[model samples]
Target: MQVDYEVIIVGGGPVGMMLAAELALARVRVCVLERLMETTPYSRALTLHPRTLEILDMRGLKAKLLDRGKPITTGHFAALDTRLDFSVLDSSSNYTLIIPQHETEKVVEEWAKSLGVEIRREEEVVAVHQDQHGVEVVAVGPNGNAVLTALYVVGADGAASIVRKQAGIPFIGKNSTFTAMQGDVVLKNPPESGVPSYFNEQGLVMIVPLPKGMHRVVLIDPERMAVPKEEPVSLEELRASLLRILGDDLGISDPFWMTRFGNATLQAQRYREGRIFLAGDAAHIHFPAGGQGMNVGLQEAINLGWKLAAQLKGWAPDWLLDSYHTERFPINTALLTNTQVQSLLFGSSEFSPSVIALRNMLSNLLQIPEANYRLATQISAFNVQYEPDREMEPHVLNGRRFTELHLRLENDVCQNAYELFHSGSFLLLHLGSDERLYDVIDWSKYKHVHVVRASLAKGAPDWHDVHTALIRPDGYVAWAISQSESNPMEAIRKGIIHWCGHV
Candidate 1:
């Protein structure tokens, strides 16, 4: 049975395109099936958090994205009065990048195309079936119906995913409790409040700046809480909501796009089923708090992309593929919980004195540096830590993201940790005088792993007395060895086999 592609991704949005690029980087044959012939004009997600920026930096896309976005040093939590200071994060990319989702899609699509990833536009997936070897996807495109087969199929097709439904994956969560309207419009008289957000008994209203002199206006009208998701948003309704919430509409006119959203949250019971997998909104959906919807989806894509490619390439450990679900399911569950709490905090339809008091108390708590930093880490996703499956005692750096480090190698050559990840391979970085560390692993058998001996740059703390560390392709530490360890060579052998499979 010949497969048309090693992987076929449904939905060519940010998540789908990101995964396609990751797989293509590994020399995997991949294709994307997008229902729309052209990209959407609507700008859904408006910001990318710090961790997302770091992931892009690893792929060398961060500079290009920065050129297209506004780097904001601060972010908000549930539109709280207190700001989440991104400038204090312990990463090179210590800020959020504010860019429209359409622009982001364009950048990623361009990268995927450069990697020779085929995107079949206007192809709407209707049916999917899987066998022991591969999966067949039936879609209707401009040329009519067609069937394509791939070793694996990923559903990034949004909350109402046809692929997830056809795969019989349970999407369990709560229904919509409140509705909101968003519009990108030209203002005859713009408000003086720059990127201002207000929440009160009337409702919540926010105005954010967009490209091309257009402004994005979000309105949550208590009276319109019952509006169906299918209902169209009108300029008059938007004006009334703004007037009710913000005292004026700022003379909003010349609308470019408008849409309605709800607080319905859901998560797929499982991320994989046989040869089928799910990512992005197909796996989870929740309130658009902290602008995390797209960012989390992109992270999920990166986490799953390389593992799937490794499996197809026949070098993946047995637990590698399943780890995608194990690692990300909990993250998505926490995301849903946070957004639900935010929805409650921001909801005005059921506003009461107690709710206001609660909001005030939480807002005050955010003033504390530790409290603010903790929530900021969660929202920025910098606090994500995976538990290593190995039996050895875990070090502090194990299972944590390998932060970009300045290194001075043997020849006085200087480099950063992110530069080693350009090829999407495991990096074995030795940071001490032990040249014998390289002899421990049989590097000849691991084609995708690189070994480098380097010393930490001056003024950097000696990290956990770590002499050697194994970094996964997604930039997380698989395992690390300290100088005080009794048997470092044997530990390296076990770590390689645990993460990189049989050599």
Candidate 2:
């Protein structure tokens, strides 16, 4: 059947744009239908976690974001005072970039456009339908409604996803029992020094600087906790919240943006339903704690992007398409739990002395480096690991996130391994001098895989025993063949066929 696009993405947020770009990087024909003609003005999601920075770094997009955002070595968990330290991570992109959501969306969108991704703004997708052959999306715009067809459709739409509903995917979670308010404004009498979160019987409040001449103030006020999320927030409301919690407004004035959000957490029963798939807020929604929402969505985009591209390009194994849900579902499940846990700490319902004491205790525990590192890895998403496929060679590196490796080329020049992934090709990195497999596997057939024979320039303890490794497009170790293997060359051949397709 003829399709308008290889993939049609609904929603033009960061996740949708990122997925579109990733697919386009592989030369897949893709389109994005968005309701807004322009990017959002407000800085919605404030921070990009460490793992997200790593993903962007692999694509060579991290430098642009670094130019636009502030980098912080620390991240928050449940509004704790000690803060999770990201500097301990072993990568150049270790710090969290405190860029506004708008900044992130624009970067991904520009990259997508540069790659020839067709984005139809001011077009809202109303419904999605799919069968064994293909999927169709109904969109409404100023020009009027139109139906678009594609081999696959992805829903990057928000919490109230029409795609999920149309596909009959159950959204499992509870309604919000409480809400929090935040605003970007000029803090006339701002705190003199460091920005710290305040938690007391009055309320829990956090204020951070934004990109423009504005500060983002977020707090869970006890008195205003039960207000519906749909209600509009006013400058007086924020001023009142400040006075109630911190005793002074910090000379708050000149409101730029204000809104109320709730703790209504939801997750899709499944990320994929036949030809239609879900990503970002369509897959899961949680209370905005630790600034992890948008970061998680962007991660999902990368995970799903290359797989979809592979499927459309006809190099994907049958199981490759299904692996997207298998891999990301559990990660997001933990994310939802983490947000709910943070919601409890934020005093979603009761703000009593005990809750205050609990927060203090956790904060103190985080001061210990071990405890801090444990939570830091989880919050930064460095802890993600997928199980190795049964057909592949078994190794510890299988399914683990690929850390940046300093590699020396055959010509003796050295460069970072992440630089090789910018083209979105599977990297067949043969660290040892085994070239017999090269003759066994026809190089012309596996055009989608980038085979590089290089040695580790710098010592990476785990990679020391690796004779060869197959790295996925999204920067994850798919298979690592140990030098100890008696038949290492054969394993390398199977690993390539396992991921890059038998063709």
Q: Give the winner by TM-score.
A: 2
Could you give candidate 1's per-residue lDDT for residues 337-452 as a string of tens digits?
99988888887346566777777899899999999999999999999989864665578788988888888888889898888898889898887767676677678888888888
Per-candidate count of clashing residue pairs (backbone under 3 Å): 0, 2
lDDT of 2 at 118: 97
**lDDT: worst 10-residue window of model 2:** 187-196
Instruction: Evaluate residue 352 in candidate 1 and report its C-alpha lDDT on the 0 to 100 scale.
Output: 65
Across residues 255-370, which tens digit of lDDT does each residue of candidate 2 receive?
A: 98899998888899999999989999999999999889889899999999989988988889989999999999999999999999999999886789999889999999999999
How high is the CA lDDT of each candidate model? 0.89, 0.90
Off by over 4 Å in 2: none
Residue 206's lDDT in candidate 1 = 77
Candidate 1 ranges with C-alpha deviation above 4 Å: 458-464
List clashing residue pairs in candidate 2.
188-251, 189-250
TM-score per model over all chains? 0.97, 0.98
